[model samples]
Target: MKKKVSLGFKLPAGMKPPEAFELVSSEGADDPAAYLAHLEDSQVEGIVTGMGRRFDVSLISKLPARIKIIATASVGFDHIDVKAAAARGIAVTNTPDVLTDATADMTMLLILNVSRRMREYLELMKEGWGKSLGFEGMLGFDPAGKYLGIVGMGRIGQAVAARARAFGINIAYHNRHRLPPEKEGDAHYFSSLEEMLPHCKILSLNAPATAETKELLNKRTIALLPKGAIVVNVARGDLINEEDLIEALANGHLGGAGLDVFKNEPHFNRRLAEFPNVFLTPHAASATVETRTGIAKRAFENVARVLSGEAPRDLVQAP
Candidate 1:
């Protein structure tokens, strides 16, 4: 008989489970608490989830012992407490690489939106573009010939560099270790992010959120950038201190910002919406049809593999 599995949320179209498994739906309630309540007293061997839920130690301890794997449909596993999952002998898997290009593309979109003041221009158009508009009225800075500093040199960071190069932007990055000359190309590397910040006219945060990275871009770090610098974050929302970012943006210390993620998501700071210099998007960096479908497929494949006495291809280690 095939193993029983429950989906915390509905799968994308055409990404059905294999015949070897009996699939049950939790409808759209993918949150940890709701999903657990839905599966109460059930004997399912696997559960599929996404980044929306918080699978902390408390929740992990309460999960049914019959559950063997928790497959998340996103690249980031920070939402899942991997250590707690490992201690319970429950495997956790994430969908990486599939969303790399999609996220990188969104990063570029943020850069352009903030630098060119697209949000303000769009609002102006809605208000009739004004009859007496002058060329200098809505002038914005061009990214060409500017230095772009990347905080993380991972696959997505490298992909952002490739896209930025086409716009005549010079790339400099700070990572734990320097990349080989072949992989780095002409991009410069800095061992210390603080040392690299002053030279960056446009800064992008692409690092993962960790103990060391949480609130990494606080007031002290923001002071390192040149006055009137632009900041963009496509990574975790916890990376930046929103209070500090808002203060900087208000005082004109930061010329503008583009953010796609937030610490208190779904209910992010309302003050940010009032700032014309800020461009915000609900955490949809990897929202393309193709990428989302790929992630959903990979997540289910992980669940199917683990239930069939096979190791998942994208198993995440405890942090």
Candidate 2:
């Protein structure tokens, strides 16, 4: 008999499951009932999934006894309850590092796009450039020499700092703990997010979604930034309060914003699209072909490790 694993997301082209295990196909999140049924198979020992579905306690409790591990393709594991999986003696892992550069690149893309008013200019070009602007007609700020305060100084945050430095942007970061000098480089460190905000002309959120970080950028925090500041988020969406952000944009408190994620994904407030100063993507920060393929490979490797009675490489919670 062959070991079996279920895939909750479509694998990239030319990608195949490890020969050691048999592949089980299901509708995944598209058809929950069918996906759950597939999980109930006695031979299925592991699962590779994506962020499209939530694996809360209610769902984790229903997992079959044979399921030993749950591997998520994306770096973030907020979609799954690690504690709940741990309670059931199941291991949970995530794909990290593979998508860092891709996500960091997207962060810079959003920063530059928002700073240069690319959304409005792109629209004008698409609509056929009907009017010529004077020197100051649609002016945008230059990122060069501007202060960019990052909320998190992890892998993605450090990558963003490296990219931003090439553009002559000064980097400042607020993390739970300061990085070593070598890793910190010349960037200023702020232990308190509130203390760092007033000096940042450009704010980038690269933190994870946790109890302490959820809604981290509410109205009060947003107010701390200097007026006309540009905001960007390539990390979790719940880090910001959309309603408060919208109010700031409407009141001319913020110059612009670039967002790749939202509190309510695939169903964000339509008003965000209404602002010409706001640029949005459907959480495609790590959507590059290379990154996506790498992430999928990592996910499968994690499952293989756990199924083979070995510890996973990026284990979040192991039981």
Candidate 3:
């Protein structure tokens, strides 16, 4: 008899269903709880995709002992506690590499959108003010002469820096370790966040989600920024204190923000949306069809590897 694994995913209906496994999906669920109860009752290995905090180990109570692997369609594993999964002797895996460039592209897109007031112009056109190309309209800032501080100098952050150079941005970054000169020589590294924050006219965050980075941009750090500084976050939502960010933008202490992720996803930060100076995206940084499909396929392949007892190349736990 073939092993039956339960898959939990919230994928596009357009996404092709996996033919290789027996699946349990969100498409048919009245709620995720009903699906989890079903999985808990069954005695078999589990396969999951698009699993975002739906089946955290504690939530499972007496989790299936037969379940050996859990894989998620998302690249970030903050939603699933790897430490908890590892303690259970369950292998947890995440998708990476495929979404880096696409995510970086959205980061740059947000930066351009907020800095240049691109959204305002589109709104202007919709309001029938587009006919005249006059100098009376919004005066946007050019990034070419600006200072850009990137919070994380990882793969995705490096990609954003490369493009900023074409706009003549002098990039400075803060990270745990300095990127080697060969990897990111154009960016001058700062070991401390304080040293980097004051110099930035634009700050883009690309750090992975982790305990150390949660609310990394709280009120104290936000105070360190120069007046009229623009902020961009496409990495993780929890890194910013949405309340503090809204206050900073509202009081005019900060210039504007371009956010692709939020503290509460699929839920609105009502204050931020009302600001003309802010640009918000629906966490679609890696939402391109090509990127999403690639993430799914890679995640599925990793699930196969983890279940087979081979070391998953991108395993998040060893923690």
Candidate 4:
């Protein structure tokens, strides 16, 4: 007999829940409160969720004792309280590697958007490019032959470097450990972010969110970049200090910025919307149909693995 699991939300198209699982429903799949309420009277052995809900200690304590595993359908698992889950003997898993290329592609798009001032240009076109545009007006920097400093050299960061190399951009990365020559290619490695910032004409944040990484980019750090430097972040919104970034963009210390994630998502900093130099996306870096479906499949596979008395491949570590 196959064990049963519950999906906290609907799976993306082309992906299906495990045949052995029994799906359960709540008033709202994305609501943590609703999920807890539903679990109170449910008999499911496992629950599949996403980044939308908070799986903190409070909520984890309310989960049914029969629930043995939780699978989140995203690469980042900062939203989940892994330590609490582990203490409760509940396994937690995340979908990674699947969204690496998709996120890296979005990073490149942000780089281009900020460096070329694409948002401002598009707005002009939408309002009608009637006025004669002067050559000196709305000039933006070219990324070719410029320095790009990556904060993290993980899978997605490395992927971004590979794409940037084709555009003649010089790559320098700061990571906890340096990569070997083969994996690093022609890229330079820096052990310290402070040492790398001055040389970076363009800076990209790709590090995961943690106590050490949260708000890593702030006023003092932003001041280290070369004047008029461009910034892009496809990583978690908490990685950068929103206030500091806004000040830099407004003061022209930063040439421009492209951000896909915000500290307060869905209700992102409204001040950023007023800046023509700042381009923002509503946290949809991995929204492509193919990538989303892949994520769903991976999350489901994790649930299936644990239910089958096997260890999940993408299990998350306790903090």
Q: Name the candidate that leads on TM-score.
A: 2
Model 2 Cα lDDT, one tens digit per residue, 1-319: 7788887766777766568777776554365555677787535899888888888898899888889999998989999999999999999999989999999999999999999999999998999988898778888889999999999999999999999999999999999999999999999999999999999999999999998999999999999999999899999999999999999999999999999999888789999999999999999999987898999888888888998899999999532
Better of 2 and 4 by TM-score: 2
Instruction: Tell me the TM-score of each prediction against the true structure.
Output: 0.95, 0.96, 0.91, 0.96
TM-score of 1: 0.95
Q: Cα lDDT of all candidates, in order? A: 0.89, 0.91, 0.80, 0.88
Q: What is model 1's C-alpha RMSD?
A: 1.6
Stretches of model 3 off by over 4 angstroms after superposition: 10-19, 28-33, 40-44, 130-136
Off by over 4 Å in 1: 13-18, 28-34
Q: Candidates ranked by lDDT, best first?
A: 2, 1, 4, 3
1-319 per-residue lDDT for model 4 (tens digits) = 5566666666667766557677675436456666766776666788777677778899898888888898988989888899999999999999999999999999999999888989999999999999977878998889999999999999999999999998899999999999989999899999999999999999999999989999999999999999999889999999999999999988889988889999877789999989888889999899998998898789888888888899999999996
In model 1, the Cα lDDT at residue 82 comes to 96
Q: Is candidate 1 or candidate 4 better by lDDT?
A: 1
lDDT (tens digit, per residue) of candidate 1 on 1-319: 6777877666666665667688777776556677787767456888787677788999999998888999988878898999999999999999989999999999999999999999998999899875766767878899989999999889999999999999999999999889999989999999988999999989999999989889989899999999989999999999999999999999889999999999987779989989998999999999887888888788878988898889999999996
RMSD of 4: 1.5
